[model samples]
Each structure stands twice: as structure tokens, then as C-alpha cells.
Target: MSTVFLALQTNEDTRPIIEAILQDNPGAVVDEQPAMVKINADGRLVVRRETIEELIGRDYDLQELQVNMITMSGNLDQTDDEITLFWKS
Candidate 1:
């Protein structure tokens, strides 16, 4: 299996997003850079809307991730509830 990764700017606003990622994908590996954070996972990674809402105590839009996301690698699948990235094996 290949590793899929996503890079996002490191900032206070992104903190909860990172937390939600960690909660949703237990296998995700985080790389904290000078001003960015990168998360890597084998095969798949998912971001759930409800989890973000819970983390920030407010509704969230998965599209908000794009505001901080610098890059990503994988096939992206999205819905009202989640955003998923995976390599088809």
C-alpha cells in the first residue's frame, strides 16, 4: 500500500482540524513543520464534519480544510458528512 499525505498550514485555526484528523484516523502520522503540519496515513485518511464541529463547538464545513491545505495526494471522495482520501488497491 502507498502512503497518502496532506499538508496544511500550522496555525491556531487549524488546531482543531488537526485534532479531528487525529481522532478520526488513528493511524495518521503527523509532521510538524516550521509553519505547516503534514499528516500521513497508509491507504486511507478521512475527515469528518461532525468531529470538527465537536472539536470547535460549532458547525464546520469540510471545504474549510482547503483554506489551509497546501497539498495532498490520493483519490478524494467527499460528502456532506466527510472527506476521504484513499488509494484504490
Candidate 2:
């Protein structure tokens, strides 16, 4: 399986996003930089709105992530509940 990744700017707002990603993707590896956080997973990565909301203790719109996003790699699929990234065979 190939790797997929999501890069988000590091800040208070993104801390919960990163936590949610890690909670959902047990195999994901995180790379922390000075001002950016990148998460890598083999084959697939998923970000769930529900999990993020729980982490942040409030309602969350997936679109809010765009504000802190820098870059990503994979075939993007987004819905009301989740965002999934994967490489197509």
C-alpha cells in the first residue's frame, strides 16, 4: 500500500484536528515541524467530523480545516461526516 498524507498548519485550532486524525487512524505517523503538522498513513487516511467535534467539544464544519491546511496527498473524498484520502490502484 502506498502512503497518503495531510498537512495542516500547527496552531491552537489545529491541535484538535491532529488529535482527531490520530485517534481515527491508528497507523498514522505524525511529523511535527515548527509551524506545521503532517500526518501520514499507509494506503488510507480519514478525518471524521464527529471525532473532531468531540475533541474540540463543539460543532465543527469540515470546511474549517481548509483554513489551516497547507497541503495534502491522495485522492480526496469529502462528505458531511468525513474526509478520506487514498491512492487508487
List TM-scores for all candidates, in order: 0.96, 0.98
Those runs of model 2 whose alpha carbons end farther than 4 Å from true positions after fitting are none
How far residue 59's Cα lies from its native spot in candidate 1, in Å, is: 0.7
lDDT tens digits, residue span 1-89, model 2: 99999999989999989999999999999999999999999999999999999999999999999999999999999999999999999
Candidate 1 Cα outliers beyond 4 Å, as residue runs: none
In candidate 1 the C-alpha lDDT for residue 61 amounts to 81
Clashes of each: 0, 0
Write the residue-wise lDDT of candidate 1 on 3-51 in tens digits. 9988999999999999999999999999999999999999999999999
Residue 4 displacement (Å), model 2: 0.4
Task: Say which candidate scores most in TM-score.
Answer: 2
- Give me candidate 2's TM-score against the actual structure: 0.98
For model 1, give the RMSD to the true fold. Answer: 0.7
